[model samples]
Target: MIACGLLLLCFSRKQYVGKVLVALGFILLVISSYEGISGRILRSLESQYSPINLSQVMAPGGSATIQDSVKWIVVLTSGIAGDATLPYQLQVSHHSRVRLIEGIRLHRMLPGSKIILTGGTGFDGSPEATTMSRVAEELGVSRADMVLEVESRDTKDHPLY
Candidate 1:
């Protein structure tokens, strides 16, 4: 950025007044990234929560086999768009319907376990609970077993999930 600004100093020289433009560009990038703010919030919230195993989270890295004897099967809501299906969508997203399917199958542990969907924000800036609700219903998750908490976009913060 400093180099680019110096180049722009074709008008004069990049350090028109003590590298002011370069400093300004860096500040803009930092502000636009929202880097520290969101990261700090997430880190604090994560640390506050009692740590659970990867199996506890629906994240892709774990292979823990959830047994049918388990009475409660809570799953994090997959935040990907429900209406999408294409190569690009799959390529770009770590969230998949397959994870939901697995969660549902694992959740069919007798009549006690329930499903919890935990995300509620959309790319279009709309609320997302309705989409999760629709998918649960479509997948034949018992309406009674399905619990929706549309208020939070963070699954880790959602207790049910």
Candidate 2:
């Protein structure tokens, strides 16, 4: 749109306006692509989360122990691969896998807490929660300890369900 507008302005003999628009667009493009600026924005958002102390949660024997009031470890699905030929564990996306792993870690640290996995069938045609459940099961999380809220297609739907 900016390019088309600039071209139209140039053809209309408004060279000054066209040049200014082109310069402004170039500056915006450069600013948007700058890694340092984007990285700082991401870091600022991530900093809102409280830091986790794994040493306090994991016992000397490498088992997780609970001492918190958390009753539910909710894991929101990130994404999934649609390929049915692959194993269920391999079907989860990298981001989703990381989230599931963190959820599992927290679950292990909270004894008697239940895991609530939420996601519906996305564009890829598989329910993310189902795939996450399979991975959690493979990691030794009992079936009774997990709940599948599989009707949620997005975060907005999660709270409603």
Candidate 3:
């Protein structure tokens, strides 16, 4: 949209139409990029799935009150900034950070649960799983309890790994 707007603005005979297209394109971009709006849009799509009853599956003192078979919490990461100069938390995207935190929370609730972090070397050549593992360590998760799958480049490749 932005590209089309720029092209119209540069070569189109009608300058006013080009200006309107450019303005509309910027507006659409802002609407889509805003967190509150985008988050609500995502939530609407996710509303079909019912939330889990954590109370039924989890118990106090890092033990399950019920016979909960679920153990591994696989964290399928989107992408990381992968900047070596930055801290581990800073290198992860917001979605990855949230997923990691939730995975750690669930791990704490389940005594023997493990977190499987997945992602390959992203744009900056740093492994996303390694970055998440470091952050998880700082957050008090044991390295022994974490599994890193750093060969999957994207979500589609995760099942294969």
Candidate 4:
């Protein structure tokens, strides 16, 4: 839509605004199409060579055993920010994300280990603890099994708070 509008304007002697709009539209189009292209290529390649299950690649023998003697896991959780209702939309940082999912994967190897999920809805939206609970369920832990602290907001009270 914007591309066509820009084309019309470009042909009508409005070179500056037309070129700017064309560039903006082109950037948006390229960004949108890039996801489709990469997704399609990845789907094709996955169909060709990748295994149907991810566990086959990550773990070989399904030897669910932790390397060291770890009994408890602590996960600092946060909410994801959408495009609207935020400046940059702060979310749980990538380091914290990895500490969660991958940490869950590792914790699964430890028998009788408990997962402690901390953090609440710092923003005025959904609570982070609720989302983290869902993630724990997805990672094979039950809601009854997770220790969730829903009121936590600041990191200063991470261990005790």
Candidate 5:
């Protein structure tokens, strides 16, 4: 829409219509992408919850947290590049990297916990979970402590797999 408006404004005789379209398109784009607006909407729709404090939750011996039954930390992957030329760390999406890192952190703190990395061979033909696993290993997590769910296509499929 923005591109159409710009083209009409530059090359067509309907300059006034083009200007109106350009203004509307810009306004819509800004409104859709603005974090403050989205945050306000989310704040209205979601319930507030207490944030977790590791210091208070984890046992003093670094063995188990207060929730001794907790055994798995699931980390869902967003996506990854299929390009073989790129290193595993470079192929993982930034969001996936952050999530994997946090999962690894939790795994370390919880001792017996395993990190379940989830994703599938998406459009790029690269299993997102495999890429996450390689990066997790590079970050010092043992392969034995990580389970890769590499058949899920998206967030909805992650739990199913």
Candidate 6:
């Protein structure tokens, strides 16, 4: 939408404004197409978290080493494609899929841990948590081990409920 608005302004009768809009639109197009911009942004956010060793966590002696204080494994939902025709896994966004995989892995490693899938229905009216739970079930995480927090529409609501 921004791109279209800028492009329209670029073709306007005001020559000076059009020229400036053209330049701004070109810059916006370049930034939008450049994957590195988004990569760096995501990297900056991910860098805040300490890395986890799944191998050590899944080892025979590893279960005894985990902190007892850590109980629930929370997997925050991203957007879903909302395509019923697609497979459950394919319906989830890339980021959400990765998060679900990691959550499932953690749930398997931690014997008594339960996974909390958090997300509400998006604009499509299909609950994100439902999609996530379907995929998790397909991946072998039992329903008994999962908790669906389907009321959270966004990040702000996730922590609250």
- Best model per lDDT: 3
Superposed by TM-score, candidate 4 places the C-alpha of residue 98 at a distance from the truth, in angstroms, of 1.2
- Residue-level lDDT of model 5, residues 83-143, one tens digit each, is 8799999899898888888888788777778889999996777688988999999999998
How do the candidates rank by lDDT, highest first? 3, 5, 6, 2, 4, 1
- lDDT by residue for model 2 over 1-161, one digit each (tens)? 36955895868777777877888888888897899988898889999997778677767876665555557888898888888888988888898898898989778776878999999987677688988899999999999999999899889998877
Q: Which structure is stronger by lDDT: 2 or 5?
A: 5
What range of 10 consecutive residues in model 3 has the weakest lDDT sum? Answer: 59-68
Per-residue CA lDDT of model 3 for 56-157, tens digit only, reads 786665458764587788998877885678888888889999999989987877778889999998888878898899999999998999999999988999
Between 2 and 4, whose lDDT is larger? 2
lDDT of 1 at 88: 27
Worst 10 residues of 5 by lDDT: 44-53
- Who wins the TM-score comparison? 6
How far in Å is the alpha carbon of 136 misplaced in model 4?
2.2
Q: Which stretches of candidate 3 lie over 4 Å from their true place?
A: 1-37, 59-62
Model 6 residue runs over 4 Å out of place are: 1-22, 53-60
Of the two candidates 1 and 4, the one with more favorable TM-score, higher being better, is 4
Q: Model 2 TM-score?
A: 0.73
Residue 146 CA error for candidate 4 (Å)?
1.1
lDDT of 6 at 36: 96
- For TM-score, candidate 5 versus 6, the one ahead is 6
Off by over 4 Å in 1: 1-71, 82-96
lDDT of 2: 0.84
